[model samples]
Target: MMKKTLTALLTVISLGLGGIGFAAQGFAMGSDSTEPAKKADDYTKAVDLIDDEEYAKAIPLLEKSIKEKGEYADALNQLGYANRKLGNWAAGMEYYLKALKLEPNHLGANEYLGELYLEQKDLASAEAQLAKLKAACGDCDEYDELEDSIDDYKDDNNIN
Candidate 1:
C-alpha cells in the first residue's frame, strides 16, 4: 500500500512538472513569437498598397503593423512614406522621427525624413538626414535619391 501511494505521488508530481513545462513553453511562444508574422503580413499588405499609390489604404495597415511590432523601424518608415504621400506632412514627420529614433541608420527613414524636411523647407535638417544616409551607405540608392531631392529643393528655392 505504501509503495502504491509513493508511486501515485510520484506520478502526480511528474504530471504537474510536465504541465508546468508545457505551459512555460506555450507562454514563451504565444504572443512574442506570433506577433512578428502578423506584423509582416500587415507590412506586406501596406507595401503593396503603397506601391499602388493607395496611401489612404496603406495607412491603417501600417499602423496596425507598427502596433503589433512595436519599434519596427521599417514599418514606421513606411508609415511615414504613406502619410507623406497623402500630404500629411506632420504625421509623416512624426513616424519618420520615431523610426529614426529606433534605428538611426535606417536608410528609408533617413531618406523619407529628408524629403519631409524639404517639404517643410527645413533645408538644414534635410541636409543632416542626407548626411546620415551618406554615412550609412555612401553610394546606396537611398543616399542618391535623397541627394537628388536636396538638389532639386535647392534649385527650386535658389539655395545654391
Candidate 2:
C-alpha cells in the first residue's frame, strides 16, 4: 500500500511538470494562464505574439524579454521558432539549442532542435536529441509525427 501511494505521488508530480508545465515554467509564458509580473510581461507578451504568427513583430519583443531574463528558456525557444518562420534558420536554431541548454529535458525544445539539426544535415545531433526524447517522454503526446519526420530526413539524406 505504501509503495503504491508513493508511486502515485511520483506519477502525479511527473505529469504536473511535463508539457503542461511549459508555460508556467516561465521560459515563455510558461504552461499556465496566469499573467507574469510586470517585469516579466515582456516575455509573456512575446509568447502571445509568437502564437499570433507575428514572428517579425515578435523579434524585438523576444529580444527584449531575453535581455530582461537571459536564462528564460521559453523565450529563447519561442525566439528560435519566430526566427525560423522568418527564414532566419541559423539564428532560430541557435536559440533552440540555447533553450535546451537551459532545460535539458524540455520536450518541445528537444523535438524542435532535432528537426533543425535534420534540416542542417546534422543527423548525429538529431539522433542524439531524438534518443533523449524517446527515453524521457511521458505521454509522447507531441512526438507523433516527429519521429517519422526524422526517419524521413535520414532516408532523404542517405544518413544510414
Candidate 3:
C-alpha cells in the first residue's frame, strides 16, 4: 500500500510539472490577444539583429522568416524597417504596404510608413498614416511617436 501511494504521488507531481511546462511554452511563444504567437526561429534571430542595428544582416533572416512563416505582418514590418534604415526607400515603402495589406491595423507599419513619408517631405501622406495609427490604437506609443515626428518635421520645415 505504501508503494502504491508513492507511485500515485509521483504521477500527480509529474502531471503538474507537465502542465507548467506547457504553460511556459505558450507564454514564450507569445500567447496574447494583442499579437499573434510567433514561433519562427529565423524571425527571432532577425529581431535580435534589428535591435542591434544590423539592418543588412537582418534582411535575409527576415526574408527567410517570411518564407518559413508564410508572410506574417510583423515580419513584413521588420523588413520595411530594415530597408528604411538602409535607405532603400522604395523597397521600404513596398514592404510597408505589403504589411498593411496583410494587417491594416498594424501599428508599427503605420508609424514607420508615416516616418517614411516624412522623410520624403510628404506631410499630408504622413498625417494620413498618423490618422490610421490613431484609429488602430488610441493612446498608444506608436501614435505618440508618429505625432511627435510630425510635429518635429513641421517645425523644421516651417510648415506652420
Candidate 4:
C-alpha cells in the first residue's frame, strides 16, 4: 500500500511539473516567435505606400500588420498617419493613442499625433506631444519635425 501511494504521488508530481514546463514553453513561444517577421513584411509594404502618399492603399496593409502582430507600435503609428492623411481625424487619434499605449516613447506617433492636434487647432495638445517627444529623444528627427510644425502653427496663427 505504501509503495502504491509513493507511486501515485510521484505520478502526480511528474504531471504537475510537466504542466508547468508546457506552460512556460507556450509563454516563451507566444512572446519570442517569428510571427513579427511576417507582420514586418506587411508593415514595410504599407510604409512604401505611405511614402508615396497613397494612404488609402496603406491603411488596409497597416491594419493587417497590426492584426497579425498584435500591439505592433510601428504599424499602429503608420495606421494613424494614413488615417490622418485621409482626413479621418478621430480614427487616426484612436490608432495613435493605441500606439502610444503600447510604446509611450514612439517617436512617429508623437510627431503625427501632434500634427493632428495642430490640424484641429489644438495648439496646447500639440505642444504637449512635442514635450513628450523631446523627453523621449532630445535631438531626434521626430522632435525636430514636430517642433517645426508647432513653429509653423504659431507663425500662421500669429500666436507670438
Candidate 5:
C-alpha cells in the first residue's frame, strides 16, 4: 500500500522549481522533449526502479542519467530519495541539497529535505524547508494541502 499512497501524491506531484504541482507520473520524464530526450528516458527508467522498490538498482541508473546530463536535477532529487529509502541519510540529503542548489524552488527537494530534518527531529530545518515550499510553488493549488500536511507532521512530531 506504500506505492499506492505514494502514487496518490505522485499523481500530480511535483517538487519542482515552479511548484506548479506537475505530474510525476504518466511521463516520469518529458517524452517529446527536444533537448536530450535520451536523458529523460533514462530518468524514467530510474524512477521505475524506485517505484518497484529496487533502490539499489535505481542508483546506478540514476547515476547514469546524471552522468549523461550533469544538470539533470530531477534525477538528482530522485537519487536522494532512493538513498533515503536505503537508510543512507547523509548521502541522501547531500543529493537533495545538491538538487536544490540547481533548482532553488524545487518542491520535492524542499519536501524531502524537510522530511529528513523531521526524521532527525530537527524542527528548525524542517520548518524552514516546508515554509519555503509555499513561496516556491506560488501557482500550485496543492500548496495549501501540502502546507497543511507539513504542518500536521510537525505538530504530530511535536516539532514546534
Candidate 6:
C-alpha cells in the first residue's frame, strides 16, 4: 500500500512539472498571451487573401489590422503589396514607406519597395533598396529576388 502511494505521488509530481514546462513554453511563444487575437487574425486573413491573389479583398482586412495594431510592419508591407498589385502606386508607396519608417530592416517591405522603384524605371532607387536588403539580410531571398530584378531591368533596357 505504501509503495502504491509513493508511485502515485511521483507520477503526480512528474505530470505537474511537465504541465508547468508546457505552460511556460506556450507563454514564451505568445500562444498564451493575454492580448486579444483579433488583430492577428485580421492580418492572417489578409495574408491568405493575398496568397489567393485577392488583393482587393485583402486590403480592408490589412487596413483593419493596421488600425487595430498601429505600426504593424508586416501588415503595412502586405498592404503595400496589395495596392501595388492593384496598380495603386502612390498608395503602395505610402504604405511601404510607412512600414519602412517603423521597421527599416523589414525584408518584405524593402523588396516590395524596390519592386515599386523598378516599376517606375528608377534603377538607382531600386538598387538602393537592394543594397539595404543586402545589408539587412545578406544573401536572403529578398536580396536575390531584387538582384534578379535589377539584372532583368538592365538587360531589358540595354543598360550597363
Top lDDT prediction, candidate number: 3
How would you encode candidate 1's per-residue C-alpha lDDT over 22-66 as one tens digit per residue? Answer: 999867763211244546687889889999999999988878876
Q: Write out the backbone clash pairs for model 3.
A: none
Model-by-model lDDT, in order?
A: 0.85, 0.75, 0.89, 0.87, 0.75, 0.88
Candidate 4 has an lDDT of 0.87
- lDDT computed for candidate 1: 0.85
At residue 30, candidate 5 shows an lDDT of: 44
What ranges in model 1 sit over 4 Å off? Answer: 1-38
lDDT tens readout by residue for model 3, 61-131: 98987786688788899999999999999999999999899889999999999999999989999999999
lDDT of 6 by residue, 57-126 (tens): 9999888887777757788889999999999999999999988887899899999999999999999999
Colliding pairs, model 2 = 22-30, 22-31, 23-30, 23-31, 24-30, 24-31, 27-74, 27-75, 28-74
Give per-candidate clash totals: 0, 9, 0, 0, 3, 0
Residue 159, candidate 5: C-alpha displacement in angstroms = 5.7
Residue-wise C-alpha lDDT for candidate 2, range 1-160, written one tens digit per residue: 9999999999999988786677556576435222355236777677788888888988898788667755566777887888887878899888988887777777777777787777777878887877888877844843654687788987887777
RMSD of each candidate relative to the true structure:
9.6, 11.1, 2.9, 9.9, 14.6, 4.3
Give me the displacement of residue 105 in model 5, in angstroms.
0.7
Q: How many collisions between residues are there in candidate 4?
A: 0
Badly placed stretches (over 4 Å) of model 3 are 1-39
Instruction: Write down the TM-score of every candidate.
Output: 0.74, 0.65, 0.82, 0.76, 0.68, 0.79
Taking all chains together, the TM-score of candidate 3 against the true structure is 0.82
Instruction: Indicate the TM-score of model 4.
Output: 0.76
- Local error of candidate 3 at 21, Å? 7.3
lDDT of 4 at 33: 17
